[model samples]
Target: MAQRSVRASLARAFLYLVLLSLLSTGIAILTLASSLRDAEAVNIAGSLRMQSYRLGYDLQGDRARLNEHLTQYNQSLRSEALLNPGRFWVPKEVRERYNAINDAWADMEHHIRQGDIAWYHDNIAGYVAQIDLFVLALQHYAERKMMQVVATSVVGFIAIFTLVFFTLRRFRHQVVAPLNKLMLASKSIERGKFAHPPLDTDLPNEIGLLARTFTRMADELQRLYRSLEDKVQQKTLSLQEANRTLEVLYSCSQALNVGTIDRHCFTQILQLVRQQEKVDYIEMLVGENWLLCEGTQQESVPWQSAAITQQDDELGQLRWQASVGSPPMPLMQSVASMLGRGLYFNQAQKHYQQLLLMQERATIARELHDSLAQVLSYLRIQLTLLKRAVPEENEPAQRIIGDFSQALNDAYRQLRELLATFRLTLQQADLPAALQEMIAPLRQQTDTTILLDCRMPTQALDAQQQVHLLQIIREAVLNAIKHAGAQEISITCTTSSTGEHTAAILDNGKGIASLSEPEGHYGLNIMHERAAQLGGRLTISRPAEGGTLIAITFRSSSSDNNDEK
Candidate 1:
């Protein structure tokens, strides 16, 4: 746990190496210095033998210069290098040899001075041998000092190499390995992961602190990256949902805004909702009328309902079976509103078509009255005149003339009735309203109690269907008024779920004798023809209470007829 620094450690290692180097250098210097002048001392000692022989030669051959040679020999014996016994390199054997040589030289000198030639010659060789011993000692001491210097140098070099090897290993562990880890950690962070091994924060170096800081930074980055990923996923889901919602709304709007909106169109809209929203069941109801329905009802689930409304007018209720979660109310409401507008537009179109048809019928009636009806009236007048012009006694001709006149009158009356039927005035596409208007004028002509009941849906009939139905009802009512003389009359109209229409006129008057048409009356035949035009059959029955009941059943429009259009 010590606060060790890389710089300080390196500095200490360097200083230790310097000290080791200095110690080795000092030891080599001291070792080599001990042998200083030892070589010179050996040379000077070897020269002493030569100097002794020269002195002996002088004693034998040049006795005139004998003192001079003796002075030289004394100087060589006391030479500073050889005679310094206080020096550490100087050996005791060399010094003892020097003392013996000096004592023998003193005796030789005394003999030479006393003229003893025999003593001088014998001691000279012995003295030379002692000098040889001293020189050999100096040589051995110098060689030993050189060997010590070599050993010291070798040890110092090995120690320095060992310290360098250990120092480099420590540097690799503490510095290089940790820096490599940091590099790998940085690369992992770049790849959006933290996959590297843990760093050694316990290291006693600056790299340890740096590793700890980097780890915390990496942790923060990873947390932020995860949070960002979660947000992106949520946003993707939200956008997908919004896109589906838009698709549903756009499809529904397209279905409702077409030119001829029908049950099929609404059914398609319901299908769009089912496919997009995965709903269980859906249906539309206008009052008690089910306009369009899809899917089966599931009693286990509650129904979610929205009003089919337009401009504050709630035309119907749209209901669907959904699970526990609430359905999209706003989208449903928008579809319902579009349905309401479609219904409104459908009614308006029907009314426009009815108006056009009525106008065409009125124009045809005016043309027929101006041409055919006028011609028939003129023919009737001519027949009357011809009858009066005939002879009074001719009975056969009179009978023929009277029959012709009656036939003309009947044809004219029928023509007038047909014209009135064609000129049927209508202000709206409502069948019920048209019925009421038709009955209003008849009510003024009859004191008979009359009742009307119409339960048919307004959208059940087309313009042609309305015309045929009204004509049939009028003929039935007129017949009841004219011949079924007794009392009450009732007109009832209804529609089935399968779009079949039924109209009945019941009377409480004299019952007809037969279903067959009477010879002179064509009203029954005409009513039957009108029913046929409606793509239906008519039934006439005499009730037991003595009244006639006339009823007609038909579809609003034949599929074959619509296909032709």
Candidate 2:
């Protein structure tokens, strides 16, 4: 027979299980039927012997009982229970004993009919003895038959037990063991182990197929992992190059903030890149003039140069020379791009000034659209409702008109505040003076006592940092005065000994309750943005003195202190 797979084997095993169950049932039934038949045969044989004795007694002394005894004896000899059908295997010795009993009965009956009392009485014992022999034979046969049944039952139980044990063992080896291995492999995989032990695949079974599939899948994973490793390496190199480009650009931008993006800025940029990165030679060329050519001592080797472009005009070129290693083409390009912007340094300053003007105007427009516009629209709706209520000079109509008028006046004041904010340029580059000027108006506008604490270094912040710091302060103070219903607002700008600067706007307002600004509020957001521009952390909290405290703390050019406000 061809080797069976797991499916066929499983089916065969199940069939065997069913067969064993049926065989066990059949054995039980056979045991019961055979035991019953054997017992019945023994019982019939014993009855035959008793009937013979009774018949003999009747013929010798009691003739009235003779008929009954004779009828029973004849019936037992011919009983289907004893002489069973053709299917029954009757012992030859048992048949001989039955024939002897029949022969003895026939002789005794002839004597009994002739009225020979002495002959009949003497020969009747022989007839009964033969019947007793037949009884003994049948009893032995029944005992033997019972023994056979016991042996068969024992054999069947042993066979079934063995079959079940082997079936379970086979299942464990073929299915359970393989599954356990797979589970172990899965656990190892979780721990980042990829290599797995090979399972048996020679068996043309489901487990074998699974093992083969797992092997293929594992191979595929290994291939994929190898491919990913190569890609990751390439990506890592690309990312490192990208980071270098960004660092170069950032250093260039920082240089531009202090110095114009001119010949001087390019020299600082090339020097900054030289300090951390590998470079043999870097030169800035403005019409063949080497503005910057600084790096390690020159080793004669490969050189690359990128054009420095400003808009559509090519102003100059940035050059690099390496003995063995040249920077990536992209990095060179990025550095060139950085140098290109610096080539038109004067124009960059004008562009920056233009951007600031545009930003200030945009901020004013945004504030109007977000705040004053909404209030005016609401007032317009109220005016429409008021006209509808014109006929009725009710108190509600008067209240509506009053609210409309109040909203209109508030909107006008907001528009004025917005205009005043956007008008002043922070060219003075003085934090204390700007804060004082900003607070002077707020102080005149409100009953709030504005205390100014100006203990900052004279040149701690640059021009733009000062401007952003002042704006952040103005925004904080404005919110406190307008929204928190503050009675006294104190502004503080202090530089600690550790060089950290703290700018705080504290007010005796409803503190925490006013901190959760309503949606569409831009003043708070603008304050945060300005603080971020100053490289400071902004905080708004309620101090124990019972009002909102908005503070910004940052590191100045001369200091290195962490944010704490």
Candidate 3:
């Protein structure tokens, strides 16, 4: 970008130089031509004046000679001597010589006729002197004009040369030099070195401004690079920490898979969690249901499970409560209820293990969805097309080829779709928009009526809170649709009194049977987890009518409070 800017600037500078040179040359040529023409005119005028002076002199001399001849004839010679062939008007050279000798001859003749020789001589001399002065003035004028013409030509040449030379020099220094520097800097930056600074020197006019701007741009780029480096370093540390946590989680999962359901297994899990440098405490409960606690203990409360009918004719409940607080009476009651459910169903332990695995897979699927599924879809399409282009060979060959291709495509598409579903569960947009879009697909796939009564505040929610609320609401609605077996479901969201937001999913279906049973639902667990992560609470209840209600509440942002204020 910098190089392009410099090139454009240089191009403009070159054009300006060309125009200036043309203008200067044009003016110089005009002045020089004018001077030469004036000089030629002066020279011609000087020559004409000199000739006129000589003619005047000759006319005077002729008149004087005529007078002298008349005088001599009267004194001695015969009258016919005046017209004698031998003495015809004197030879042209002699006449011209006599005229030169005596200018103003016509005036002299007029004076002689008036009998005023002294006055005629005086007027003749004065007139001759005036002609001489006029000739001298013309000569002086011509000489001066010639000198001026020469001087003008010289000056014009010098000006043209000076303009051309300076223009080219300035083009090279201000334009070409800066352009080359920009190009070199760009190339170096492209090769991973961004250290070059722009030239800071006295430049011609606009070029100086451009150079300063380029320098500022370089400084900004350097700052951006430094900021990016810092962010990358921080992200690297975060990823490392995440990886270590995953490793430990993996190890625990493997141990759970190998070990039997016993106190030792639970204790081992708790010990491993506590071993974490960042963790403060760990607790586990097992019975008809189970509740595990990790990190610092603030409070625990009794759990109540919403009753959900299973395909099997068994009446059981299983719930898991994980909290980061001291054991409270209500939480302990919730845990005791979950333990009662677990004790009734021995498979509860295995089910809990599966839930953990599902959570991990869900997380992994999300990552794959964001990074790899798109690529795999493209590959699957390419492979399918390639397979179609190939002809069916012998029976065995066709069978093997078909089976392999079908299996690979099926696996690819299933993995892609699974990842996509997990991503949808995690990602969110505007609450109203997301709810509308989610219902579109659910309405197409299921017979459940998903009614959204979302009365969000006048101001929109923050992105993080919006996403969290959307996920919670989605999970609640899906649970109602799948487990409650409801033909109609309603989700209503509204701002709470203390500037908190709340969403409720209500269904006119089966409700909680016993205080310990919770609809045998995994989504309930997910909703609870999401709510906890958002520093909120999730509640499930059976209304007086035969239906279930899932309500979630979380604190609104400070900005929302300010808006209310």
Candidate 4:
């Protein structure tokens, strides 16, 4: 391809050179032919002038001689007539001479009368002078013509030669030379050198076009090579990072297998994470309820269900609450979720574990109530009977009975409280009725005045959301009574314009600590967590007027809450 291109270029150059040479030669030849023709015409006029001058001079001499002979003939006739009458022979001689003279005169008169000789002699003289002038002009013209021919021939030769030389030289330098360089560069590129060659800059014609083409090709190749290199490097780095992550996952799985089901296992998991990956806080929760374990009390630590399922029914989630150098929240959730998928398929197992735990606690509470409480009651009765039977003098028996009765009463009370705690674990009841039930208990138990300032909407909440909202309100009210030292508490439930359900609990007492404390304020955190689990939010704020307000909000879907009639 390169050779063909080069040959084609050379051929074009040759054609151009030939055309230029032909044009130069043609112009020179035309000028020379015109000069030569002018020189011939000048030479012919000079010859004609010289001949006419000689002919005029000859005619004038002939006319002068003829006039002299006529005068001599007239003298001879007068001598013959005056001398003698008897000399006939002399007269005849004279007549014969006269006849010759007459013939001569007749010839001269005929010549003069014809006017050809006179005109010829007069014009010849004029032509002779004209010839002299013409000779001078012809000499000058010949000199100029010779000079012009020489000058034109020299200039024409030089111009043609110069045109031919430069044309051929340019053809070689422009078309052939650069094309040769380009071909060599192409061959080198084909052989894998990939080095760019210098382009010819001397020619501003077609060769310049070829050089630019080559330069563009080189630039494109360089760009493609660099792009491919970048892509390969990026892919390699990505694969390396992926491999490292997989290794970490494998190690985590091994550690899980070795650890136990207690708090120690949770600590071990946290330690492994801390040592392996730089993290801000790590927490391991046990059982379905995410029961807090010792050494995992950092407020910043995120509490998420473990990724691995503890039991067949319970799923485990591991979350990173914060990282020393990483961005917060949703990012952490994404990372934890990705890692968690390897351990647990879904959160259903976690709910199952929670239910099982609830069942177990209930069973234990029932056993304690049936057996331990009855025993304590029997003991108290025996102590009362013995105290009555003993005499007033039996002080020792009285004291022993009194001590025994007190001990039995304490045990009975403890059992009753445990039973109440267990009973509270029942599923959520109706909203208004459940709220009324909770308020009655509060009124009976504490001196604090509790008021329900609720404008219940015609709509109701979903079963799950209602349960969560009630739990959050219960926790808030209890916390207010215990911590805030509130004398009066107001609970209000309302619906928002967008069909959202809102419940607000207001306490007129010292506000709780800021919500920043994660573990210390368990009640608020639990409330927030429950709200979030039900797709709701809990906001706790203290007003400048010296009261703490806790509000819970949730969405009321048709399945969850009845629409307003």
Candidate 5:
């Protein structure tokens, strides 16, 4: 059978107790009834012996009452309640002694009735001895039966007590022990300790099942609590990251809104990110130039980086080194985007200003052409007339006149060149087209062969960069033709793998051996100034192959190199 529950077990224990009590009481009652019956039989036997004595006493006392005593004795012997010893739980020896007493009484009655006093007297001692023996037998039987009842009662009590004791022990171990464990486990749960003790399945009872259920509940709670905690922590981190990103964007917006976006402003932004990111180092760059740099990397791992860019202008990249799990990539991206917009705005303003300046230059060029060209032309004509009017015999005055004329011619040429430079504009959005236009007039003016070699990205330079770059090339080409008397000039424009550009003007000419010039020699100075405006490094030198090479190397003011590591 399946093991009982605690309730059933208790019920069973009570039932066992009740049954034991009933069995013990029954044995006691049976023992008591048997003792009572034995006692009654003993009493009956005493009465019979007393009656025999009374009959003898009556005959000795008075012969007139002899028949009455005999009659009483006879009636007592015939009474079944006194003589029927077999009806009680009497011993066989008791019944046999009673029967012998009955026979002796009958014999004594006959002697008394026949008037044999001496014979009756001689047999009366044996008859009384028989009655006494019968009485002793009945007493012995009652005492023995009573003793048996006591021994049975004692044995039953011991057995019942032993059964109840073991039953209670089973309740303590199986029911009480398991219940106590469950209570302790519940207390632990209340205190937020979800780990539980092992269930004792060895006991196949309801308490064992309860323990197993509680253990499962605790394990489930631990799992759910851990899961909930993890989710909450993850959400907290996400919120923290979002708040940090918002803070960065707010600062960037403030800078942009206040029009304070400059090198110092960007440096403050880098420090701000450094404060939040907890990194070993932080640096920002536009191509290779660092705008902001802070801290130092004492570790071997490389910094993670993100590009700062707008629609086309790549402002720079932001780089930082942090430990594992502490990355501010989203914040960095926001910073990049905000800074990129600021830089784009700055570039747009510059472009707008350059356009305005170009318009003014063009207007000035037109004015110079209208006023200065006419005056220089008239002066050249007058000098020619004065030279021709001078007499050939006055050689010294003729030579002076010729020198004056020559000087006027040179001034006119320089003025024309300046006007052409000012009038120059990009008719097409390409470097080659602008170069072709700048050198087209030169080809007609000089006997030089101009070779144009151009390799560039499709979306070349901005308007301001294009203007400065073209001016530098034009100055170099003019220097090669007019100053060096070069016969062959080649213009090359190309981009490097890093997206940096180089524009070179080469000439097969009598190379100038001197890099230094006297004061107010404006040719090289003008070219150098133009290169500076383009943010290009300019170099002019006699190549080993016997030619002057003027080269300007610079990167676009926009995009970063895609292959930058």
Candidate 6:
């Protein structure tokens, strides 16, 4: 069936009602107009009765105006209302009764004209009765027209009422109910749920189209809502990760900013990395030394490692055990790089301390060399002149003078060694460069080859340790130069896997005659003392090939020195 819109249905219903009302109006108008003519016919028929009585009174009394009464009666009987031929308002019974009155009046007229008063008296009542019957017929006709008017009015009202009732019902079902459902759906969407049942789309109306459109729009909205939720969740996770990265970086920076970095500090930084990256275990290794480690090692799981580098120098390795899709390499590497910088700063701080100590010792050495060395040299010269002046005459005085001079000479020599020891200075932070500088003057003094190989870790030695180690090496080299009288000195420094440092000074020189110190000479004793200050063992040995080797072995001050077995 063809679909009709609400507008068309309402308009059609209104048109039907209007047509019904018009039909009723038209019928009522026709009936009322006929009723008006019926009233006039009844009045005319009633006047005939009055005229019959008046004519009867004229016959009984003087018989004067009898022809006039008869003429009036005949005119009333043939009146337009009673005798009109084609008036549908006039009933057949009224017409028949009017014709009967006319027939009775025609006989009465003959008698009255021939002076027949007794005949007129007898027929007058019968003619009035016929006139009464005519009036009753006209009344019945008017009543019937009124009945038609009432019936048309009642039918029109009933049809219009039915149309209104059914139209309202359809509107409720097709328009109002669907619109309410749409409103409810809108409310459900507002609450972030698509909970409403499906709308009816099969109706052939605007409501059906609206329902289908609303359904599609709701589906699209639901999809968009889900998408938005996912996006929001993703953004939140991104923000959280960014916050964690920033926190790790900031904390690592704080840990590195201190004056000294130790195993404890590195452990803290690694812990921070573990917390941020959510790793199982993490550790830092500088060369073979594991400086700091956090969490237990799971050898079953392969570790993800990043080089801790600064300016292309790989300072260490950072290793951790994490899942396959762990945090990106850049973040872990960034943390590793930050730790590398911390190690660099630690080395630099140690160097700075060493430099300050060397500078202080040099200052003391300068003060002593300028004042005390001049006085000691002058005294020694004066004592020598006194000895020469008294030597030929008095043996006892000469002997005493010789003893004093020898004692003075020994004291002067010991003071000079002390000055040299105090004057030891490191011009740069690098140990290799400082060692080269130390050996430069010695190299110029002899044709012997002096090779220095330093391979110690940057953080292995502190200021005091470097000072003591340098003193020990210098003393050993000087003993080779002055006493051994040999050439070809090689100084090599290395670190073991257990973080132990070893420095060897070898020279193809005459071996020492005895391990004991010579009388009034304490070079070897002082060298041993310096080694003791480093908390190390100094060993002197003659190789089978006839070279003297002096080496010191000690653990690095920076490490726990636990060797992995």
Q: What is the lDDT of residue 151 in candidate 4?
A: 73
TM-score per prediction, in order, is: 0.54, 0.35, 0.28, 0.27, 0.42, 0.54
Candidate 3 per-residue C-alpha lDDT over 1-565 given as tens digits, one digit per residue, 9 for 90 to 100: 2433445655776676677566656665654553443344334433433443343444565655554444542332112211222434223442332344235545544656665655754565565555455334434544654565567656656765676687678678767787787778777776768787656445645556666777777778877977898899999998887676666565555545543343334345545545643334444432222234444543454332323223433333322233433233343333334333333332444334434544775898878876677766776686678667667666675676677677666666556544644555422233565568666776776798888887664123444455556667766676576667888888888765446777888998776454343432244566677788777898888988878888888765554442221
Q: Model 4 clash tally? A: 13
Model 1 lDDT tens row, 1-565:
3378887888998998999899999999988776676777778778777877776777678688888877877887788767466555466776676677777778877887776777778777776777777777777767877888999999999999999889989989998899999998899889877767898788877788778888898888888988999999999998887787789989988887777665567778888987778888888787553456677789899888999887898878889987745557877887788888877787777778778888998999999999998899889888889888999899999999988888888788778777877888777666788889888888899999889998766665666777778889988898889788958999998867566778999998888778899766688888899889888999999978779999999876553222111
Candidate 2 local lDDT, 1-565, one digit each (tens): 2255767877887788778768766866775676566666768877765665666567657687676666766787778766543444667777778777767778776776676778866776777677778878878777776777677778777877888888889988888888777777767666767787767766567777777777787777767876888999999998987887787668767886765444456567778766645777777665432244577556556667888777777866777777656667776676777677655554445346545864776688778767876777777686777667677658786776777677676656656666655655543333566667667777887887888988674333544666677777877777777778887888877777566878888888787565655543456766777788887899988888788888899876542332111
Q: Which candidate do you rate higher for TM-score, 1 or 2?
A: 1
> Where does candidate 3 stray beyond 4 Å?
1-363, 366-421, 425-428, 458-460, 513-521
Tens digit per residue, CA lDDT, model 6, 1-565: 3286877887898888889889888988887875665666778788877777776677678777887877777776666666474556466776676667667777877877887778877777776787787778777777887889899889888988998898889889888998998899899999999868888778788788888888999889988998898899999999988887788789988877776875557778988888777788888888753456777777788878899998899877998897644767878888898888877777677678888888888898888889988888998889889877885779999888888888788878987888888887676555676788888877887777888988875455766788788888888888888777787889998877677788999888888888788788888888888888888888989999997899999875644565210
Clashing pairs in 5: none
TM-score of 2: 0.35
Model 1 pairs in collision:
none
Off by over 4 Å in 1: 1-243, 497-499, 557-565
As for TM-score, the candidate ahead, 4 or 6, is 6
Write model 5 residue lDDT over 1-565, tens digit each, in one string: 2376777878888888788778877877886775655555566666766776666666667778878777777776656544475666556897788678777777787877777767867877778787778778867776776787788788878988898889879888988887888888899888888766766755777887777778888888877987898799999999987887788678767766754344555656766777766777877766442345667775786778888898866767877887755566777787888767766665455455456757877999989988988998888888778877888899999988887777777777777778777877554444566578777888998988999987754233566677788788888888788777888999988777676888899998999767865343556777778878877789979998887999999876544354212
* TM-score of candidate 6 against the unseen true structure: 0.54
Q: Which stretches in model 6 have alpha-carbon errors above 4 Å?
A: 1-230, 287-303, 391-407, 497-499, 556-559, 563-565
Q: Highest lDDT: give the candidate number.
A: 1
- Residue-wise C-alpha lDDT for candidate 4, range 42-88, written one tens digit per residue: 45444444434443444556655544443443443233222222445
Clashes of each: 0, 0, 33, 13, 0, 0
C-alpha lDDT of candidate 3 relative to the true structure = 0.55
Alpha-carbon lDDT, every model:
0.80, 0.69, 0.55, 0.58, 0.74, 0.79
Better of 2 and 6 by lDDT: 6
